[model samples]
Target: MSEPFYITTAISYPNGKPHIGHAYESIATDAIARFQRMAGRDVFFQTGTDEHGLKMAQTARDRGITPVALAEEMSGHFQTMANELNISCDRFIRTSEPAHHAASQALWKAMEANGDLYLDRYEGWYSVRDEAFYDEKELVEGENGEKLSPQGTPVTWTAEESWFFKLSEYQDRLLALYNEQPDFIRPESRRNEVMRFVEGGLADLSISRTSFDWGVKVPDSDGHVMYVWVDALTNYLTGLGYPEDTEAFRKYWPADFHIIGKDIVRFHAVYWPAFLMSAGISLPKHVFGHGFLLNRGEKMSKSLGNVADPLELAERFGVDQLRYFLLSEVTFGNDGSYSAEAIVARCNADLANSFGNLAQRTLSFIAKNLEGRLPSRAAVQPVDTELLETVRNATAIELPRLMNDLAISQAIESWIKAVFACNQYIDAQAPWTLRKTDPERMEAVLGTLFIAIRDLAIAIQPVVPTAAGKLLDILGMGADQRDLAALTAKGWYEELGNSGFTLAAPTPIFPRLEVPAED
Candidate 1:
């Protein structure tokens, strides 16, 4: 059996329509999941909406609808965005699902049984937008002398009857976990920030609230619902049938990664681990808090009128193109800026001019001149051997190493370098010039490119699945042969040649994309 690798994106809060940020996270997570699957892991990837929260309640009230109704409607948009973006998640969990409620309550009961839960009157600063409580010390004064959360969001003083969790008691244990597993929180920067925050000292957390009823209700406690984050975080376990002894839970628990935005690192790194310790559940392996996406180097906001709808961006620029640009341009743990110009320039240079042009010219030449027949083993040359080795090193070795470390952009950089090498090889070989003067040598050159293109297409399949699949289809590669293992396998080329699977005239997979006109 393959080793199990489980990963999840922070379930999106569906209080509003999906934006570019949401799409970026989903795309990045999906790419990583695909890479793991291709590398022979049993990967279970989950993403969806966190539908229960005060924001949802307030939005529903303003719109004159029940919270459930609003959740259902808004959650559909996120699901649609995931589908349209070709996110290959195993489950799209919703917090409002009955199974999720049971799981949340089970967790609550477990923590309570551990003496971690207590009833209390809570008074503190809360950011309804963030759905989180903040220490008075953590709050900063705004320009107008108003109080703001650390994220610069406005905070309101909130006092209510609530249930509290003994977060303060687990501070030492949480710090010990961080010390034992240095990579429990990723990117070093986020890890350092989390450590500093925990080192400062932790207070008991407010885990249940009486101010709202649009959440999982506290078991045996009337009129109080579980705090939004409490239920929200539980969506991870709920999808795996937590509270039940299921095979999935047994196999895939202690998730390998919880891919989230940088802003929520504290919630996942601190509060979440403490909750799990209280409930006697093993913690996840890693929490990767990825950086935010900026719009043209500036923060996106409604007031700035730069909040791009992800679906529209997908429609304007093909899904794979958008995926490629984000993963290649963004340094994974660092913030990335995107604009129409940037997307078009990057995709066109890498996809259209480099890899796409290489595939189009080589395959088209063979299809037309060689009547779709693959070059036989007798046509092999020394140059062919050298180029193939270069391609193999990049696709099978270096790329995998970088991806395994979660250095996504670096992985892509390695793949593109291989593509550039192929381009240079093709240029130097001058196969078109040799077509007439040395026709047999021409066959060897085209055949070499055929093999190189196959490796390139397979290696990049995680990031640009559609385009890569299209090229692989035209190359007549088997589904079983499009994996990392397949790249290093010998005689596949000779096997293909002997099988008489003649290539047809190829269609261009990566067409040039034009920037959309600004409105």
Candidate 2:
């Protein structure tokens, strides 16, 4: 049996509606989880909304609604979007849930027991927008010549009685832990940045907010609420039934990956791990911080009026199209730009023209010439053997890199390259011309092409799931395999190496997108 694998996307803050950024993270994480499942792993994937925060509180007040009401409505929308995108999350944890509250409080109690929790009077610059306290050196000058938070939001001086986590005490220990296990933070660059930050200096972090009552209440403290990050990060454990439930926690704790955006790299890589260490819990294996989607040169943001409404994009084109565009256009862990024109171009070139057109033509030829049945493989040609060998070899090379390094976009590209090679093989062999001259050779060629297409569909499913599934259905391989694991050089292919496939009438997998001519 394959080993157990656990992954999670950052729990989104329910301060606003879902945008392309949220969709991007979800789709990327979903692909990884789906791929792991295909690899025969017991995968636990979790995602949900961060409903306890000052932003959610203010949004509630602005709309004359209770926080619970607003969070419920927005959380439902997030769920709807995830379902629409076919997100295979095992748990959708909400921090406001009783289970999550208990788990978070339990973590606080654990830290207290560990002597990491202490009472402190906080007097510093706080950014309400970020719900974070910033040091003077970390602040930058605004256009108005005032100090601003790292997020560019203005910071104000605040004084409050709060509980603090003695983050400074663990700087050397955290560094030692990271050095001991270098793979604890992923992608090298993120790891280096985190190490630099830790080495520069560490400060105690305020863990409670006395100014707001919009979060997990500090246990035994009536007037203060737990910090939003502290509350939000606990969802990972809460989803696993932590604290009260020992068996479940043991089963899924110490997640394999935490997929977060670049903006929160520091939070996930440094603060989160430190918190875990303080509580004597094992840290996660990897904190993979992927970059954001850019609209032109600027970050996509709601206030900037540049955020893409996920549902709108899905409605205008299609969910699979959007999914394909996001995953294929951008290299994972790198920032990428998105434009409608680029989306249309990729759809037309890669999808409609390349893979889709090849499928249509191959099936059409078989249907018209061979009575809609898979041609019998009576004899093998050099080209047929070469094609199958290329597939087996490429699968061997790419699958490990994709699985171990999480190189998702490269994995899809590798399979697409194989598909293009199959197309070229067919065009050069001229199976249609050979059909009359040498029917047996033609059958061999078609047989080889059919199996190649089958493998292609299976290999590409994790990236473009819906389209690949449709193509596999048309090819009559849908029932035989659900993933690339089915395409191995096993007894089935070798035993029937001379057999032919009964082809089906193919439909366009991805129809070409056309733009209107300007008036």
Q: Which ten residues in a row have the lowest lDDT in candidate 1?
A: 375-384
Q: Which candidate ranks first by TM-score, i.e. highest?
A: 1
- TM of each candidate vs. truth: 0.99, 0.95
lDDT of each: 0.94, 0.83
Per-residue lDDT over 68-129 for candidate 1, one digit per residue giving the tens place of the 0 to 100 score: 89998999999899999999999999998999999999999999999999999999999999
Q: Model 1 reaches what TM-score against the true structure?
A: 0.99
Runs in model 1 with CA error above 4 Å? 377-379
Clashing pairs in 1: none
**lDDT comparing candidate 2 with the true structure:** 0.83
